[model samples]
Target: MNSEEQPILSIRNLNRQFGSGCRECGGGSGQLIKNYCLSCGTVYACRDLSFDVFPGEVLGIVGESGSGKSTLMKCLYFDQETTGGEGYISTYKDGNANLFAQSSQEKRYIRNHLMGKVYQNPILGLKMDFSSIGNIAEKLISAGERNAAGMEERGMELLTHVSIPVHRRKEAPRNFSGGMQQRVQIAKALSNNPPILLLDEVTTGLDLSVQASVLDLIKGLQRELGISIILVSHDLGVIRMLADRTMVMLDGKVIEKGLTDQILEDPQAAYTQQLVHSLL
Candidate 1:
């Protein structure tokens, strides 16, 4: 690749609006939109967002609850279709291409092989009834690893990497504490060996000590795998520890974005300053 080439993932002018009324008022339905939900009886979940995720870079996206952080991550991962603007994912498998414009089949193929996601709620991303190791191995197989032995080996390695005990690997996630369950979720997300990982508040419900361990596990994995990561969290401390850069969002719009320290130490926007204060 040339030095001038863009990063692995690039999002430009992305917008996502919800509700039926916005659909009628010239804002396309599903992912696109024009007027606010109040005026058109449709909710606007995310609006005019743009960012990039480069290879081996961890970008932290911070916003309060209902600030569209999750929505923006969904759009980048193609879990939610865009209303407008362009999104691109560049990889050796597909070369450089527009993500939103890809056909359903193309998107499915990429999603299965090239990207992985960890939801804020562990239960949302994991099967409560399955053994922790089984859950991770199942995802590996689903992502195209057909070798049983290989899957088991990789699953055990991942479990260990995240600090899950070997014996506990046989236990169902329901038997694990909140932090352990989150580690299992992280292990499962890495099962695919995806080039891009979307972590949506992976540390949300954990206590402070557990959160630190989980964050350390994530940083270690990133160092080993060299995969680009997008971390969505309301916790500034989490972002400060893991992210090289940070983006701040408010009411679906990007209020400020820069290096993590720059934004935290010298916030440019009032919302960003208030968010930092809340952390203190």
Candidate 2:
């Protein structure tokens, strides 16, 4: 939480919109019903999002559905293009480059070598037909690991780290349970040993006991690897458990942000107050 330490990742004025905006809405002068423009029909999914993820820290982004938290994650991971913004990763180009404007080839390099992402849906992150270890190998290969023996060793190590049984390494993710599929996805994401991890609702929709286990696994991984993480979830409880700092988003804008303990105990924004109260 040192203010002076260099950030591993930095985003500035990030914005994403579904449709071309009219002058009224596009100019940031008109009011919208929720996040959609009534006149021009442009949906501003993410607006002016800016944040930093410090080394070895978890920065939680909490928001309701359609609050643009997931959109922000997508932009960061390059699953979706940003309409406008700039992003810098300390591990890339000495943090001098804007990631949003990178060429496709450069973006691929950054995605493969500098960052990892685990999607809420395992299908989005894992190839359902591929063996669990094969999924991990795919990531390893993308990161330029051409030696099959080396990849197998790395894949096995990652699967074991995520608690996936050795015997089941050859099974496809389609055969695994919800929680197990997520574990495999996590293993695959970590296969390249990326410095930054993006986790979008990793524990969502799991049974209570299963959710607890996945959260604990993530907590342990962060502590062991010392990797910076950006975790997006609507669950305040999840943020409380893992995040050192938390940001609250509403209607595609950041309403409040601060240390997790401070926000939970004395939330400043009215919307944040309701959210914190609900966690009781």
- Candidate that scores best on lDDT: 2
Tens digit of per-residue lDDT, candidate 1, span 46-148: 7788888888899999988888889887887777887778877777345567778888888877777788888888878899999998998878777677888
Each candidate: RMSD:
3.3, 1.5
TM-score for all models, in order of appearance: 0.90, 0.98
Clashes of 2: 0
lDDT of 2 by residue, 1-280 (tens): 4533989999999999998889778544477888999988999999898988898999999999999999999998899999998999887888899999999999999999999999999999999999999999998888888999988888889989999999999999999999999999888988888999999999999999999999999999999999889999999999999999999999999999999999999999999999988889
| Quality of model 1 by C-alpha lDDT | 0.83
Candidate 2 local accuracy as lDDT?
Answer: 0.92
Model 2 per-residue lDDT at 66: 98
Quantify all predictions' global Cα lDDT against the true fold. 0.83, 0.92
